[model samples]
Target: MTNEQFIERLQQPNWSVSCKTEQQVDLVLQACRTAGISSDKREEIIKVLRLPIDIGFSKYFDTIEYAHNGAFKFLELENITSWFFDAIKKE
Candidate 1:
């Protein structure tokens, strides 16, 4: 997906679990891993990302907000996008 598409999807309020949403989560996590994000930091990201959607969909918004706010300190937006696209291509 294009970065704009990715961002648009992320901003959507729906956090219902589906094959596509699961794939999106996997892509984000894989991107982080491929970029050599530290395990501890990845775990932290995971914790935020995995928060239950049933609990008001906070986790979905929170994860996107965290990424926008520089949770992955070493990664540039371009790098994150690149990693995400690479992960998608690999799948």
Candidate 2:
């Protein structure tokens, strides 16, 4: 699919939200599943989607662990995205 088409698919609101980072990663994963996106391709796709490339599987797992530990609050996607971007920039 073209980047625009893949992006349209991702914005369809077909998925649920529990953890912000996990849901975003899953959305990209599902979009890439049929297209056979490789690891590098996955990162590129996320960049097109305007998400931080560093917010990959490990970050999703960390989000889940944080939620499980009762250490997270629901945040807007924009907030989470900005926070991820800032966190990566700091590192």
Candidate 3:
């Protein structure tokens, strides 16, 4: 999906469990953790990204993570900032 689409989907307050979308979310979460982004920072970034939708949404993105996914793996601010901007442009 395009970033706009992803952003729209993410803006929703709830997501029902599904086989497909779950994996993708997990992938992003896991990648962020593996990237070594702190759980706090990962959350801060996600929060910032979600500001357009519901500012409150940013506060709780992590509460909705896949069961096994604790954080994004190998998450570097530079890389993530790039991804966020790129995704926004694509949107």
Candidate 4:
């Protein structure tokens, strides 16, 4: 997909992300099940086998993203970033 398309998808509120192998995706699916979230929910399960290291934090901070949208509270850095990585994984 194009960069624009990717950026657009990232803007969506809900997404079901998956990693390679069932073992990789197990945690995410389990969380969804525990939350009682159905497969039809407004979530996207992107199956990317690998991710580039260079595609780092830079892509996440867009001046135009929430610049003049007046949606300040919704686009807080802490909130957006926490979704991208698992907190416990970093530990």
Among all candidates shown, the one with the greatest lDDT: 1
lDDT of 1 at 4: 50
Question: Runs in model 3 with CA error above 4 Å?
Answer: 18-25, 28-62, 65-91
Q: TM-scores of all models?
A: 0.30, 0.24, 0.26, 0.30
Could you give candidate 3's per-residue lDDT for residues 8-91 as a string of tens digits?
544443332211243333444443444332276544454434221211123245443322131222221111333433444554
TM-score, prediction 4: 0.30
Give the Å error, residue 44, model 4: 17
TM-score-based ranking, best first?
Answer: 4, 1, 3, 2
Candidate 1 pairs with clashing backbones: none
- Alpha-carbon RMSD, candidate 4: 13.7
Candidate 4 local lDDT, 1-91, one digit each (tens): 4434444444444333423344444444434344334242222332232321011111344211212222334433333334433532542
**Residue range 1-91, candidate 2, lDDT tens digits:** 3555544433432222232464565554544343343256544444455323223222233221112222233331222344333333453
Task: Please count the clashing residue pairs in each candidate, in the order shown.
Answer: 0, 0, 14, 1
lDDT of each: 0.38, 0.36, 0.36, 0.33
RMSD of each: 11.4, 13.9, 13.6, 13.7
lDDT of 4 at 67: 22
Give candidate 1 misplaced runs (Cα > 4 Å): 1-20, 44-83
Worst 10 residues of 1 by lDDT: 51-60
lDDT of 1 by residue, 1-91 (tens): 5655654443444232211244555555544344333255544554455432111122333433233333333432222344345536755
